[model samples]
Target: MKIFVLFAFAAFAVVVFSGRSEVSQANGRYSTGSIDAPTGVRSTVNLYATKVGVYWDTVRGATLYRIYRNTANDANTATDVGTSAGNYYFDLTAVAGQSYFYWVRAENSVTSSSFSEPASGRRANGNVFPGPFPPLDPPPSPSGNSVTAAKASLGKALFWDEQLSSTNTVACGTCHRPEAGGRDPRTLFGDLASRNPGPDGTPDTFDDIFGSPGVPKNNADGTYFDSPLFAYRPQVTKRRAPSYLNTGYSPNGLFWDGRATGEFRDPLTNEVLIAAGASLESQVLGPPVSDIEMAHGGRDWTQVAAKIAAVRPLMLAEDVPGSLRNWIGGRSYPELFEEAFGTPEVTPARIAMAIATHERQLFSDQTPLDRWGASIEQLTPQEMNGLSLFVNKRCIDCHTGSLLADNEFHNIGVRPQLEDRGRGAISNNPVDDGAFKTPTLRNVELRGPYMRNGQFQ
Candidate 1:
């Protein structure tokens, strides 16, 4: 666990190893065939058969690709072909008798969307799916004013409410405790922080935190409330929780594995990708569908919603007319919406915007080091020496910049005893084998059980 102790100084006598990160184009969220080109650039034809197999150039930012082929004989008989995220699909659909049409799209755990254009050729099949996503929003806060106080308050309430959980006992705040640097470290047991059942078949109970029931021989005191949130065995999470501080700055994607992105698909946007770019509010609401996190049993959102709807009134609030009204708001949902977002239409977009507004506020620009002593000029001589050593050891290479993260995944090659795959599971990329994001050292000394694995350095 390379705990960096930074000591910045011009040690003329010492070799200070420091280098800037590659200024790669900002990561984009636009998938192929999704970006809106000018009207003049639109192509009319869908399929042009020229070659034996369909092939296209590599699209940027795509890790998985799919080709949708519709045969000329039938408009409804469409074939779905799945390819790796970065690779183009084979053009096998351009059969001689079939006037085949092809449309391509990109998808990963976080995002899925259509292509911007179609490639046409007289005798050859051409794929016009733009090979990459539209670049990330160039700037932050794409379509709104700064987040507000009332919105943040509502967000905090929603984030912590157990009614949001499948069992109606957990909320976003359960895992992202502020004191533990805004993340849960209680993997073994404790509070609403986690709901994992023990292998010993102990009964769920809040006293030990997981609320697990019947993993034990006789611990179910007959009054414990550890009923399975589902009818089947639960599906534990593949990974642990991530923090929130400084995450809103990551506009293009979210999560260490990027399992979530700013361009989450909500019908409210009508477009597959909109308002993507990291926003604390957006990142915070994720994982309620995870079986081990907040998911209902092992089911997805629909199942979880149905199970909890009777006990949880908030789910029905979706159709109550006002775009922003919930039990949290005293006035009509529309009135609350006007106050929070200046609109009363009550949209998922605005809901996301409001939660995002509150989340961005979680950015902790204030730290003891930031206030009392930091920067090249403010450090004490000893602390400065430590920082210098930190940079010398190549720590600064990853922990660079004001936010102190290059935001790239690297394989530190820690002891791989744990089940966690870090970024590998989210990306399915070999390059990220046993790798994790280089976390921000903004308040490292205050955070413990270091590393995403939390192996206790």
Candidate 2:
């Protein structure tokens, strides 16, 4: 007599046969019966624009493989996408920008194995760069207040003057320097104090942020106070300082969340100064009163105006630009104000206009990319290859245009949305969670430690 037994494992199967011991001496045999499930499955889109390449390790007992796909992660929702004799499949129906999860099953003439672990991928849209560069739109200026040489000069002085801060140590230029591509360079030093624990409130984690350092916590009387987060040390901003270079070109709004609207309103009077196209002017009014950036607690525009009135222009700054120095020789803030505006009286609106005017002059159109696009110069072979890859890989989808940015917000899945609400905080939309504005690539090499949180070097 003989007995047959079959056993199935998670990934393989076995068959056994046994004979009665007394009959022809006890004998045992084992044989393979079922196929193993596919393993080491992965997906990619680097090779083709319209297809997602799904690949896997060849199974020992598989004669053919069946591919299944769905928009969600669940395998139950997946439908048969295709079949292949080899260990790979090209999903031509995969759409660009939309993510798809995939699974593979090994099969032979008799039966099929269970589905393998799922892999996810998406196809690139393959939108190439448009032709030569186009001229950038003129920088917007506030209505009734053009950018005059005198106004820009006054704004330059204010921008670089440390005395504008309540502690007389920080200025607009303290964090934004031209040499560093209008971004803070101090974060590159690896200062532990400059780090802000993200929403998780933990340190040395993936969500840790490298941010710009500002003045310590201060009382309304300009005295230092212990901060809950930093103690006596200088307070750090929640987000990294964005580059000021070429910021004038952004028309929708300013800042990572686009909170700085184009309408410039007088801080004190709430009167609309610039009705539209004055995002630069609207942006300038923020840092001066921000307690963490440049001011003491409860500091108002009245206090800022009074402080400017009391201090001489650029009193704490050195190596002033020659034109500004010549204009400011033996002059007071009131005198500079008189030259910039109609009279010597210092006000918040005039201050914003002057600073915005100065910032508008910081155009960066002389880059190598610009020269190549303009047909004034040629790109190297390596550069041409890089440009080709940049387009082919679909990096140009969001980072498009002459500015190399779409000036829109997108959540690229850099981190979990719970860690940072990002544009969602401003827009109050769940879909905008973790979305950040696309930054310009002009002089990008000079600005290291990129991203809104400065998570990448």
C-alpha lDDT score of every prediction, in listed order: 0.43, 0.71
Q: Can you give the TM-score per candidate against the true fold?
A: 0.52, 0.70
Q: In model 1, state the lDDT of residue 262.
A: 64
Worst 10 residues of 2 by lDDT: 6-15
lDDT per residue as tens, model 2, 96-153: 7688899988776677878889988876555323573432333555575675545665
lDDT value, residue 441 of candidate 2: 65
How many clashes would you count in candidate 2?
A: 0
**For candidate 2, what is the TM-score?**
0.70
